[model samples]
Target: MDIRIKEAVDLFQEVMFYGTERVIKSIDDPLWKEFSPEQIQMLKLVSREKRITSSRLAALQAVHKSAISSRIKKLLQKDVIRFVQTEQQDRREKLVELTDRGKEVLVQSDKVLTDYIENLLAQHVNDEEIDQFLTIFRKLKDIIKADGVS
Candidate 1:
């Protein structure tokens, strides 16, 4: 590989690993004690989509529908998410939505992560640099989406 491409790949890997580790550590609070990391991730996805079918979520997560169903069952037992029947003619379609408690957990988690990221950025980067990074990141995201990488 070209030297520049190799360097970029290495930097990307390092940044992803370090940033994820720091964010996970920062959010290791009592607020999340009752939830596993996978469960929290599911909640975050549901929070974003508002309501999504288990099959769609399974596709997004690259897991089997059975796995998604099991996770949904657990979330249901915890009273964090509930199944809502869609009004489609099929009538068998169900979507998962966050309960009040799920929303509260997601909000608190976002606040914690946001605070951590803001403080980290404040310590290492200025406004212009942040804007530049965001622009580049979004462009990359768009390119990946366009390429059907996910």
Candidate 2:
């Protein structure tokens, strides 16, 4: 019985992984070509503030400066992110910000992603299942956090 439960759990997790891809694909054609996940996240972050620092981004995403630098370069090349050198004492600090197009993409892509998730929930999940899943995941999250996860 224990083996059967574990097998079922693994199988269900695999199916849900593929299911997320399929659901995201339903919105991919018209929007994904214009925005990647990192782009969307950066846009959303910068949209919340006029300017943010690279260190702040690295801290939030829990990545090294080099990785964030590479991503920021790509965003800069795509015209989705901008940087300004402020006149403050710390001239080396680049004030990274999102462009108008970046914010627009974030807002629009967020709408499409929300609609896709909503449709998927209606088709594949009931309210009780969602509530249960969230409860379980959050509980696990709390446990991991309590363990002092770095």
Candidate maximizing TM-score: 1
> Tens-digit lDDT track for model 2 on 42-85?
67777776788988788876789888888888889988789989
Cα TM-score per model: 0.79, 0.64
| lDDT value, candidate 1, whole model | 0.86
**Model 2: how far residue 101 lies from native, Å:** 0.9
> What residue runs in model 2 are displaced by over 4 Å at the alpha carbon?
1-26, 124-150
Best model number under lDDT: 1
Q: Please give the RMSD to the true structure for each candidate, in Å.
A: 2.6, 5.0
Q: Which stretches of candidate 1 lie over 4 Å from their true place?
A: 1-10, 144-150
Write model 1 residue lDDT over 1-150, tens digit each, in one string. 699989988999998789777677667687667776667888988988899999878887779989888899889999999989998898799889999999998898778778878988899899999999999989999999899874
